[model samples]
Target chain A: MIFRSLLAALALMFVMSTATADQRWQRVEAVTQALDNRVPELEGLSLELPLVAEDGSSVSLSVSFTGSLEDGEHIEKIRLFAPGNPRPEVADITLGPLASPANIATRIRLSETQQVVALAITNQDRAFLTTRDVRVTVSGCLVGGGDASAMAMANPRLALAGSARPGQPVTVRSLINHPMETGLRPDGQADDSIEQQLVESLTATLNDEPVLTARFFTGTSANPYLQFQLTPEEEGELKLAWQDQKGEQMEASQAIKF
Target chain B: MGNLFSDHLSAVLWAGALLGVVYGMIAQWSRFCLLRGLFNRWQQNDSRRLRAFALAMAVALVSSQWLAWQAGINLTRTPYHPGNLPVVALIVGGLLFGYGMALANACGARSLVLLGTGNLRSLLVLLVLGIAAYMTMSGVLAEFRLWMEDLYRPTLPATDLTLVTAPLGLDTETGRLVLAGLLSLALTAWALSSRAFRTSPRDWLGGLLIGLLVAAGWWITGVLGADDFDPVRLASLTFVAPVGDSLQYLMLSTGTSLRFGVTVVAGIVAGSFLVALLTREFVWQSFTSPGHNGRAIVGGFLMGVGGIMSIGCTLGQGLSGFSTLAISSFLALAGIVAGSRLALRFSVGSSASH
Candidate 1:
């Protein structure tokens, strides 16, 4: 009896696994829309997301690309898409030479249980892809912590981590406060006071050299957080700046040493 | 950006497992269960077990509150404090869970302990309960649960011990101390007042260990697993959702990461089985008749759906949630007690027969 039940469970799992692989990515419009109806190969890209999210409002996600490319070709940018959210345009990250080992991390809002896809576009216009499914239950995507006031966006935070030689880049993380107001407020508590605004763009510089640029959309969680690799060839201050929808900008920096 | 615990989740999971093993052993030794305590207190006119439960609550409260005081952990980040307190879900869910507890003849935590001792009936109860919990939590019945919760969303924005003193012009720090101190003292004094409980070192020792285990739960997930980028969920002992998590983990190991709750559940069973073997309490047991099985099935369904509706079970809301001093915990606790009392008075079959 136990063996029969185990066999039945295994059979059911086989069907589910096949279904997950066959249908999910083929149907997501965001990936095909960016690649112009061509599905990107999942050869050299990886995405990390919790199978079950702690809180769906601000779920932490990381995507990285390490695929070899033809000579004179570099991976220029990577875009994130949460097909489940109201505003699916998650983020667009443009990488520079200083951003070694193209990797990016941030928090995004998921409206429901769905697959999130990452599309990495190279300088040659070739795209590589990876995706992960996150389950968001009833207790998901609720009102996040912190106030929605304009002043709430004041105290931007930046930090550095990871060990590398002076010529090599270390991990750079930055957080700036903003509601990422998607124009659709589920809670409606701060609907009146909070305007529909987000930190549209962010740029980082090390020793006055451009390192990273990212475009944030409404799908980004409140208090937009981001992490990427930045090279510290010479010892100087690392600066991070944020620009909101109204063209308002915020800046924060930290010292870098070998 | 999220590497500290994310990189070493196995270590955190191991800690949870160790704690679960400790809890299971202690529970087996004490036969620590709220249902058993209630049954004995009301049906047999003995309150020794009930007092032990109270003592456990007291220790958990004092220790968990101390952690919060020291900023060793942030209690406010927990799910017990949603924006709109779902008062309706609490009463309905708690009542169903209580009734289910009486019908199934064991609560979620108790059932796990029983399963460790080779009770086949507990296996059935756990499977149904886990499925039902997932049904209400994220499955087919989720829509209905969400609708009911949204229909009646009128309640205090945030209800905790400080709610009492906030209106009385006392600061939050003073209010937490004043309220938690009085309640903890009253509970401890009541437990100690019972000569039966005081005389039984084994009973009080169970209470102490379980309480410390709950606090250690918070420490493992909240403090030791604390990471700004990849923070672990602030949770302690609660069996309703964790059981479902364990079931999901069994099937979807490749897709998902191992969570603390699932590991805790696994640890509890192992720990209980170890103690049961050492004590020679490992005896195979099954339902006597079909009626007994049917009744337990109903009980399991109610517990699964109800536990999710209320967002916790006896251990989840009654002890772990209570330690946070959240007011919603009190309402759920009251509902559960009332439901169990109703079931005890009106249940058709004998509770002890199963």
Candidate 2:
């Protein structure tokens, strides 16, 4: 009887492995279809993810490129897809002309260990892809609690790394402690569909000249955070303003001296 | 310019290494050992080392609070301040660790320092300890550890000192401040109470320096290392997991990047080696007998398992976790002391053995 059970267990393991492989291929196919069936060049695109993540609520992810784009050609859109998340489509970013170099960093919620894919589209109609395997052991917000809108703009936190100087590059990181409800998920408390509320826009200006601006979607992770670089022409007040989908606008500024 | 995570990650690793080197040097120069403090106090009626440990804790508490106030760090979110308490695991692990340290003659951090000073016995202790810690952390013993966590885990209304006082109508920050202040004051008084301890400048300096370094660690991981997109985990001086991480990093360096904990492990050894060389304390030493090697091996293995189960070692729990005022830290500390006293009673027949 024990020998038979062992044989059964081995068969079960083989079946499970094959099932997982099929799912992975399906996710890749889905991403390829989203990119208009074009097989994206794997070069020049790099996806950065921690090998192991304890908290699935807010895992940091970055998509960067070195030599993917031709001269005068820039990346127009970047989409982050996590096969193991509640929603496969994590975030779709539309970059305007003034968007800081093709590198972008943001946080996303992962449900479990799975393959994460980043696909980028250039203005020249070219598609590129990069993929990473992330292992998430803990679930961050499987059950959504608390009201995301109650304390919408109470505390807006910011971390500035690298010295801020004229002609010197500085990285600005900002996180507004807000539960970005996607309207699709239910708030476990009352079984009510949480309204789709998210930070719709972020704009940064140096001495009143626009340096960076971004638009986010419902798929953007909670406590929306963004990190970008700026090399100032002259030291002045760096203003960061965020306007949520609710049309609630919050602003913070820091004086940068040259 | 490059991947911001990698950029800041390497920055955090380099910073961790520098801080670690400093720690190793100071630890060797001052002869700082947490287990020794307790053993000496009980066995020889000497309280100098104990006073140093107390002074370090007191200083760390005040400075960490100050950093939180300045940097706007919420200590509540740190790993040490988790909402649930694993009662059985902590008590059992802490007891095993205390008894192990007694047999081994040093804690994990001390073993690293001793290893740098050319003590081959410490090398063996650290290897066994690291492997055992990894076993309990993610290896064969992980399932057992998970079962213990699942069985004994109890969610508290709050995990820190604020839980008891929060219901009494005090706000969290206020409650935390009052509690931390009282504890720091009491510790400082005790450290200064003994005339012999008071006159020992080395003890006072060691305590003060180690305390400030612990606070500095919080700032590194919490403030400078804090990035909204990819912030490093908020942690301070801890020896158990880091030793295991150091070993793992050696094997999986390509697949995994260095973290604050792993760098600190490397730093402590590097720093200790440099100091030992400068002070002419770098003598090659090994186990005196087969029996001695067996004792060290057993003690190190127990410490590794205990450290993982409790989630911190003497430095990790006794200082870093204690600084946060986590209730689990206190429970683990009590368990450690009880275990140490038990070992003194049974193993050596008296407290005066070493």
Candidate 3:
């Protein structure tokens, strides 16, 4: 009987150890898979993000693309993916001819330390890729309870300015108010989590032609602020529309004289 | 439709000029000094100077809170709050800065005034402080700050200490305002009741004016400076980054945009010069020894690094942060006082030594 009991104990220990090691390996594999999946076009796109963000919510991100775009051939879209997030898509923008070749700035939310991927697609349908490892130090998004959602919502504001000269840089600024909720937050209880509902996309147009676009994630501020430059051929009306996960949308239009 | 006055660029510039004049006038009147307040309390039995500072803090807290509540302004959006606690950095940085302020015999804002009055020592300190601050903010010291953050990490959900109290079922905003106001009033009353304090209208006026300047700073950046495409950094008059910013502006005026703090720093110097010259206070001054100059330089560097690390100087954290009623600012202010006390205890000519 004693010999039988010792054999069983040894077997249990071995099984448990193997299971733990397997779990660790799985996590490592997930990280590796995230890194391996990165598209290469990101090499030409300079990404400026904090190495370690003090607040995971509304972390500032600035991206500048260096490669030349021929006439009628522009970056059709740029998509950002955060692998660790429940909903990995952070932001996606479809850039038109009028948009600047090099710059886009916005804020986004991160659920945790994970790989952030940026995929830039040109009008020719060629895709460029970049991936970065971002560590979320501490999250500052969800501080209070039911009131947080209310407090986070803000009235969207828009501003536009540029010189009347053709191909001159026209600056556009847009502000939106929303919590950009990440589904990962605990809902008062340990087991319950808040469902993510946030602004998913934003698009800007100069004279009805797309000039800039953005995809947003929970990392965006309660009132998301974005600043971008466009080189419009001629001055006309600038239209901006934002869409969120709840199917809520807001639009603002401004007439540009220059 | 947009002339120079109506144009956004000109409006901002004019606003900046106006702000500069106001700050200069107030600073000239108040003789505000974080070092003086804390140092006097430590070195002498006098707490009146300290009380005056508390009065400023109380006024700042009540007024700022009132403005936010009334105008629907979110004070937390500013750098003072950042909606995070930053406990370790605040306390540690504050203590180090407080010591340096004492040794230098003034804080950043005070040093600025002293510099205007032909205080050669202050000039040396200001240069060192500015360079050191830049080092900590973006240069060599940044690496160390990052490493330390990773090492002695706290279990804060977010670094904003207000979050701690918010969860405890207290009226977060109201509680803060009331607490600050009561403290300020109590301190002010105590100071004013004393005959010595009552007689010094010049000092009292200086404190009041400086207090107003703190409020003006918030309005400029938070309200008028708000632009969608080229948003000004949400800030007030804090010496650490501002000093570095001033230096950068001098070097790269065309490249970089002018900010409120930088403009304010410039304005203060110019304003002070005008005031001093008009008042027959301007005089050239210089130090005798290279060693003395070196000490001034080192002291300035310490003030810069310490201020950045703490996130404000005596004026920056003491007045601006305190006005916001940020918990981190309070912790930093305490640290400044403690550090100053320690320096006083050790220094040969320290008032306490006498």
The estimated TM-scores of all candidates read 0.85, 0.72, 0.67
Over the full model, what C-alpha lDDT does candidate 2 score relative to the true structure?
0.78
Which lDDT tens digits does candidate 1 get at residues B1-354?
235444546667888999889988999899998887888888788888888889899989888989888865768657776556777888889999999988889999999998999988988889999989988876788766767676675545345768878888889778888887899899999999988889998789998889888888898888777765556788999999999888877877765668899999998899899999999999999999998898689888889998988878999998898899887688778888888888888883355632
Off by over 4 Å in 2: A1-60, A64-77, A82-89, A94-103, A107-115, A121-128, A132-154, A157-174, A178-224, A227-258, B1-15, B167-169, B226-231, B346-352
lDDT of all predictions = 0.81, 0.78, 0.66
What is the C-alpha lDDT profile of model 2 across A1-258, one tens digit per residue?
999999999999999998775346345555867789676777888889888764566778888776646787977778888766555777676654444466778888776678888888888889888778887644443422234324475467665676776566577777776667655532213234446667787777777787667666544667788776666667678788888877999888877776
Question: Best TM-score goes to which candidate?
Answer: 1
Per-residue lDDT over B214-308 for candidate 2, one digit per residue giving the tens place of the 0 to 100 score: 88988888876877556788899998888888887787676556779989888889899999998899999997888788888988998999888
Error of 1 at A44 (Å): 5.1
The worst-scoring run of ten residues by lDDT in candidate 2 chain A lies at A185-194
Query: Which candidate leads the pack in lDDT?
Result: 1
The i-RMS of candidate 3 is 9.1
Residue B193, candidate 1: alpha-carbon lDDT:
94
Model 3 ranges with Cα > 4 A deviation: A1-155, A158-173, A177-200, A203-258, B1-14, B149-170, B228-230, B288-291, B351-354
lDDT of 2 at B116: 87
Between 2 and 3, whose TM-score is larger? 2
